[model samples]
Target: MQILANIIPYFISQVENFSRRERISFAYLSIENVLGFSKSDCILKNDFKINKKDIKSLINIVNQLKKNVPIQYIFEETIFYNLKFKLNKSTLIPRNETEELVKWVLQYKFNSLFDIGTGSGCIPISIAKNSNSIISALDISLDALEIAKINAMYHNVKVDFICDDIFSYIPKRKYDIIISNPPYVLKSEKVFMSKHVLDHEPHSALFVDDSNPIIFYERIIKLSSDYLNDNGMLFFEINEKYSGDIIKILSKYNFVDIELKKDINDRDRMIKAVMK
Candidate 1:
């Protein structure tokens, strides 16, 4: 008879190279995925014996974790605004700061909405689930748009997903609200990010030239005048360092009621401007 190996010790050893938080997360995900157990079940059965057949697969997952592959991509999904979004190497994983931006918009009502750089369709899909709004989402990468479309369909939200470069693209119909979380990270700022992001995530989705950190902002703001209805609103998730610069650009475009808001970390992360 084969001896059943105890789960806890092996799980700990496999995730030893990870951080404390990562260790916990990897263990939780592994046990849940392998055993079809919930987080609560993971704890309750921490000592549960595992089938030796599963050990090799768990080791592979742990090795990937050791290499700093983001669990979201490895799992091929992530939760955004309490909704599931399928992930891919081509799209940026939606962040909590974005969820805060979504929450801020949910406080106001709008009939038509447009999302710029809709990587995973997280922004528009989340809003569509809660609000009955006509939403349009655009991405520069067709590969990213494919993943976004999958997410939109999975959520059963009707969004007009477009694949085009926003720098040259123009909208035919004006929208009541425009929102974007464009590529704000500067090339010089790559040192500040983790290996998982810098190595695995799409650079086109994460970075812009340092000389023009807000290049996308400039293009989108200039294009906004043509696509925003009277009294329309524009919202942005900005790099904290460029918050003031973004506000000035919006003001230069004659947008009024400009406000800069911070995320939970107290970093300036959001800005809102209204058409006069």
Candidate 2:
């Protein structure tokens, strides 16, 4: 509808923290999702009438946005690595940094792989779709695993999903690769986070104790040698502040060929090591 263009301006006015451009972008995307209209359709049919039901849905979403709800949750789905993933409060939403991790893993060869903390199973599912490797994904949250299972099915890929704490789970067979985008944000950093993330996203999947930020990394590295075949690769999405510290931890565990990589933003966001 011609009036729909006003939706962009209205959201921009209501969202104080986000830039005007960003608010408009969110509104455009939300409208597209609600109306099932392509960019071309929206441009060519500016005068198209919006159904009352669709208008109501759009209004509700915009109201939620005004309250700082994440747009991803507003839609309950998001596109990650060119795949649609169902999202809920139980899991961390897929991010661009995680997409880069998937791309890096796909470039390498592996006989079998395990994804630790596989929220939404995006990393594992994307890798499985591209490679012939047998993949298993682990997450502690059953709700998150449920969404992951649905995503795996939607992508027509079979991934073994397990509900087990990464710290306690022991693998019977050694894997050629282990990948994880684990929770690394420190509790103190909560103050700096947006309300959308702090309030809507699962805190268990997003944070670590500030006193021991590397607890998960320490455990992952300690057990990696047992579960990874010799020369097996360990990949992680790490906190930028502790890239050097994590590399040091891996070195202490005798993980060789350790490498740290930057994300598209040029932040140190990933680390890789080969088990000796």
Write candidate 2's Cα lDDT for 138-170 as tens digits.
Answer: 999999999999999999999999999988889
Candidate 1: which stretches are off by over 4 Å?
1-8
Point out the worst 10-residue segment of candidate 2 by lDDT. 1-10
Q: List candidate 2 segments past 4 Å from native.
A: none
What are the lDDT scores of the predictions, listed in order? 0.86, 0.87
lDDT of each residue in 1-276, candidate 1, tens digit only:
011224445556766556777676667777666667777775665556667666776777777877888888888889899898999999999999999999999999899999999999999999999999999999999999999999988988899999999988989799999999999888988888778889899999988998899999998888886789999999999998988888888989999999888899999899999998
Clashing pairs in 1: none
TM-score list, all predictions: 0.94, 0.95
Estimate the overall C-alpha local distance difference test score of candidate 1. Answer: 0.86
